[model samples]
Target: AYTVRESTVFYVRVPAPHARFATDLLCEVVGQPRLDPADVEIERGVILGELDGALDTPDDVVFMNLVEALFPGHPIGRETLGDPQSLVAMAAADIAGFHDRWYRPQNLVFAAAGALDHDEIAKTIDAHFDGRASGVRPERIAPGEALGSDKSAQRPIEQAYLALGWRGLTATDPDKVALAVLNHAFGDGPSSRLHEEIRERRGLAYEVSSSAASNLDAGTQTVYCATAPEHLDKVRRIIDEQIEAIVTDGIDDEELAVAQGYLTGSMLMALEDSSSRMSRLGSAVLTHGRAIPIFESLESIAKVTTDDVKRVAERIFGQQHVESIVSPDGDEFDDDDED
Candidate 1:
């Protein structure tokens, strides 16, 4: 999908011998989509339904709200499933024009994984896609100020969903590895600090996790939690307290080692599958303009020292944060963004 903060990736996987056929098929579809008016209306209905379903889920709603509040005026902040009114107003001719303007050769990339002859595939691509003259990629949306203020909505639900987000390093930032280590140690899994404190010890939240999203030019680190409406205050406090402690005390050797191993091991394990490899290939290329081997990725993780993690933790978490709350009254959390 085309997005503001990240590159749009088109990917497909096929058996070794079927790679050429798959490439040819994808080109035909992209270069000449059958945009019948009937088909357009049908797809619009399907997409709108999916979007409506996503909004009903508390967590999804909270996350989408956070993205909107964080990247205001940017393409990333645009409605996830496109605007309902816009879709309804759109015509088949408009869709075709939009496609023609943006679906240029320069904007697309061809990538494959698994057993295949690179030369043969390249030749096949040239034969099938030749004369599809290269054109400029879609203009990247420049970022504006992130709305660091807190935003809350009244949802009349049993559980409250909260997301606390901070600006993060770009994909190629030197501290990216350290940031990954910081994320893993904070709340990536059951053993993470957020889970250990928010769920295991306090029994406050039913779900809690942290995520790092990096794009070509901008990035974010977010912590998500859902708990009984009554426990929302405690959950929010503990999250802030834990982050402050990390910035002040830093991570220990044991914690740092665990994070490094987990990060590297996960990368290694994912590469064993063709689907993972294909995704990694496309995303890596889009982010770094090249594919980084698994070993190189592991090495990068291994080199993230304790100090690196500590410094990055302080730098990222110390920024003004965007907080989002979805609860019955929108009255439980602070309206002011916290640092």
Candidate 2:
């Protein structure tokens, strides 16, 4: 059982005579057990293959490029799966140390839910973790370097995926709710601004939308579109033009009302699922030290004004913010030319 701010993940693993209690337990041993170096190499190879698989997908590659640009110097910016060179450079000791530092009892929360008896789970956890000493705090990681280059490529993919992004408000900012509502209107679902402008009106691409990334320290909002090789440059220009329009004329009353309703509806729907509720609780705990009730978030969304959305957009989508472009190997069009 593991408990977060307002949620929990309970686990009950039966230990057997020859079976290890946990795989990460190896890191807890008093001394470095003689590990076969060959086995480590094999595992590294498997991970490398997985990285290759992710890169092979166009959408994944584009999003990873965005992350690299958005979080240039940060660990969160670091690929979830480290790059080939980075993985190859890792020693067995490094893996052991990382596991020991991050997987400690103090860093964990035991939680249980559903029909399970709380006392029995608590007793089991106490039996297993009672005497275990807390580990040292993990070292803080630095911010990722911001994306600067106008163009990037992973050549083998067939389609071109592009993103024009801007830095946004942090999760705790008062305008976060406003920003979410704005983003929903701009490009959240099929009825969004980008979808209406780029896909429906002009047939620029098969898919187009915008989204926001929110966290305790910072946040970002991006307008993204995908088009075929022949239509790439036009799609980029259209996206930029639409963004400029949003910044200038501001949104109309009708658009604002639509965005408000859609955002409110989405929020209401999100809470209907148990897993989402649990996730909401856990994320609040992780990000803000406690969970914010569902009603609290809904109220925030409902109260957002058009002026608030416009102000957030102006602050977030500034000219100086980061930009990223990823294309297939030998494209003639240059993303930097637009700058």
Candidate 3:
């Protein structure tokens, strides 16, 4: 048996519930999905086509290349849409091996929230998957080191899209709540430092933000910005200056209070809907082995002080990070021209 979660945010203006929860009943589809070899080959071709399409977009190319450099040999770093060449060359056996290794029942968890009963789910799981133990728990692979600051390509576009990353906490890390709050204060939304500094005050390009890419075993946090090629140096300096400021000065009490309030409020608002709640519950169960109660998680965020944020900043930004610059491929740009 398996569970699929559809976590969606329902706007107040929409007719959908704040959150909706539905649990699927799957008895026969317990292990690796069964697809005919012909179908698999067809799907593989489709994936390869999509990868080609993505390569046509400069932004997508930079993003994918950054990930490739960051994760190296790790699956997380692996192309979400398999490498077109490798995928096209894959034998049927390769796909089957990947499935057998990652699709075991023990390696998966079935969960649902937002209008579902635990008892019914337990019964369904018992009926379908309990008795037929696959008897194998595949060990998950670890992610590789963060990539260095080398820019792989130079493009002739007017604007440069830079993707910078830092090694971040794993999904199960106890510091996740603190890191979430820190991220909010730094670059999550409009009120974040990256936005306020890069957009509102300085009037650079219109986008700047940071995000956490967390998985069961590991996570990464990245800050991204887009600016005219002429202003790339300014943008890079601003980012570095901000990181330095955070690490040394830390946030004041008022800033801390504000970040805490916004993060906690956002968390509460997110869970107010059925779909969002279901997603939260499902993700927690699948990733952390149990659902983290929303209230408790918020309380943890509330406890984060400026010191914690600074400490995290120091640890994260101190590492070798990846930088991807998207411009015309033939452009000859002096990467070290930054003042």
Candidate 4:
């Protein structure tokens, strides 16, 4: 499977015995893909179908609307799956050109995890990938300043979907670890402030969470909730209150410890899978320019203090946010609507 975000990743899982074969196959696909015109036509229809499905998904629509508001005329704001017009207009040559421009030896990183010899794998990669001219890395254009905005759409769905977005730190920012901790305590899990206050205590929402998506140059912090239309106002109010409290008072020591432990444990558990380990290795090198040891990552989380969390909260949550909502009523719930 392949995924596209700030970076594009293509991966496959196979038995340990076929590791070399998998490596060769991956190299062939990445380094020299034949963008056949007939195949492109077929895949275009597949992507269009995917686009229709995404549009029908309330969660996808709401989050994408939030991103559009956050980035506006930028490429980051556009749907990853090209829109209907773009999909129809795109040709095999367009795809081939894109592949040639971006898929360079210097811009790629090969990573593997399993019972494999490092030297043997390295030699195989060199044999397949060496001798190509090291191409220049493309310079990235950062998105401009984002202003706060609100958007709403009506859907036939029973429950309302809402998303709140704010501009966030870059992947390499010094404060990323603190932001992670804040995310965990704020809305990541059942113990998070959002889940506890909005779902467990108030019963205003069935699902509520927050996430941070950091890229090479830009990032986003978002909070999402699905709730009844009548409860939308209360849910928004509770989210605002939580943000204000965290920004003003910061998280306490116990909350800090819990968030830290949760992050560390989650990391350890995820690394147990060879695929996850391979992803970590590749993504770390691609994003940070080197592989960061697990211990180093854990230590960074451990060093995050209450002040760190509060400081990051103020930096992110204190800013104006973009809001997107999809509901039966295509309008924001008024404060007066709340009993």
Candidate 5:
């Protein structure tokens, strides 16, 4: 599968015995893809359908609006699947040009995991991608200050969708790990503050969660929920209170330990799979310029103190945020509609 974000990644999973074949196929696909006009047209139709589907998904609409509000005119805020107009205007030549411009040897990293001979794999890769001319890596422009805007979309759905987004730490920030821990304790799972308070305690919403996505140069921390339209105000108010409480009082020792344990355990468990390990290797090198040892990452999580969490919380949550909502009420969603 391939993912397109601030960066584009193409990966394949194969048995160890077929490692060589996978390497050749991967290099060939990345290096000399045939952007056939017919194929491009077919994929264009597929993507257009996806765009339409996204519009119908309240969850997608809410977060898309939130990101746009957070970054405004920046590319980071733009929808990853792109808008319908742009996709329609695009052609095979445009795709080929993009591939030629960005898919350079210097801009690529090769990573593998599983029972494989490193030297042999390297030799195979070198043979497949030996003396390609290197091109300049594209320089990225950092996004300007985030906007604190409240935006909403009207839908015919019965449940209201709410999303809150803040400009968050970059992948390289020292406080990123702390932010992760805070996310877990604050809104990541059922044991999180948001889930326990909003769902378990108050029964305001059935689906509520928070996530942090840190990219090479930009990041976002977001809280999302889907609830009955009548409970929208209560849910929003609860989310705000939780954020304020975490920022002010901070998490206690027990909460910190629980968050840390969850993070560490999850990491260890994920790395057990070869595909996951390979992804970790490639993502680390692509994002941070090195494959950080798993042990070192675990160590960082282990050392996180409550002070660290509080400090990072202040750094992030103290900033202005963008709020986006999708509900049946249109602009009147925030009015006294809550019963």
Candidate 6:
């Protein structure tokens, strides 16, 4: 679930022989989601429980808080999991309205993997979704502002969770490739600077990782970690020191090669399966309006240089950074709010 997907996708897989059934089933589900009043009521309860669960999870709360601070009033700030109040007020009509807005063929990308006849699949798709898929592209009801701020809240949790975020480059931007390289060397995996220094060396956190997320209009560069309430400041300082090193000294040749290899191998591993490839292509089209060739992606990562990474690091980390932390019963961050 913690993957690159934007929305909750509905996908069904079957053997090549049963591909037609899967196709037909998808069409039916999309065209009609079984929003019966009684079913809606039951699912509303289910969703509310999920939202409550998210609220109780310190990591989820802090991540959402960081997002809200980074992009206040934006759609991305809203928790994808429906909130309690909204779920209580929701009705079948609301679901229907959602379907009306974005379910059109123009806004959809149909991707499949495995062995199948292209012509036959086309015929089956036409038979099922031909003129039934309708509607024009929806226009923006509101625009997004990548405003940054510092925010924190107290909860009844054991450990303190913190998220450091910055305004990031969009997927289409040329700087994103270098940013990805920088992020990998910074905290993408156990071998990253943050993991090696914060968790393995200092034992300051149980969970520590950084990510570079690219959205439609903007992106988010973030580092998240959970630690003992008293250790939050130390962990933050360690992270800041690592960022400073990246921006100042820049990664050496060996580090650059390793980072590129890590990204390249990770990408190749993800695409080894058919479903992964389908999802990758489908999501790319959905997000950027076109699929980026795997070869092109690899080349971009390979071309990243130490200088390029330094430039990206300085540009990104130099932006307005929002630091959001959630502690169990601490007030240390209460008056530290700033942008």
Best by TM-score: 5
Error of 3 at 168 (Å): 1.4
Inter-residue clash pairs, candidate 5 = none
Candidate order by decreasing lDDT:
5, 4, 6, 1, 3, 2
Score each candidate by Cα lDDT.
Answer: 0.81, 0.66, 0.69, 0.87, 0.88, 0.81
**TM-score for each prediction?**
0.93, 0.79, 0.82, 0.95, 0.96, 0.92
* lDDT tens digits by residue: candidate 1, 177-264: 8999998999999879999999999899879999898876678899999998888888989998999999998899999999998988
Candidate 5 residue spans exceeding 4 A from truth: 146-148, 329-339
Mark the 10 consecutive residues where model 6 has the least summed lDDT.
1-10
Off by over 4 Å in 4: 329-339
lDDT of 1 at 117: 79
Model 2 quality (TM-score): 0.79
- Between 3 and 6, whose TM-score is larger? 6
Which structure is stronger by TM-score: 2 or 4? 4
| Number of the candidate with higher lDDT, 2 or 3 | 3
Summarize candidate 5's per-residue lDDT along 1-339 as a digit string, tens digits.
Answer: 556567677888888899888888988898999889999999999989998999888898888888888888888888898998899999899999888888888898999999888998899878866787788898899889858467787877788899999999898999999999999999998899999999999888999999999888889999999998889888989999999999999999999999999999999999889989988998899888999999999999999999999999899899888788888855475532111
Candidate 1 is scored at a TM of 0.93
Report the candidate with higher TM-score, 4 versus 6: 4
Between prediction 2 and prediction 6, which has the larger lDDT?
6
TM-score of 5: 0.96
Off by over 4 Å in 1: 1-5, 146-148, 329-339
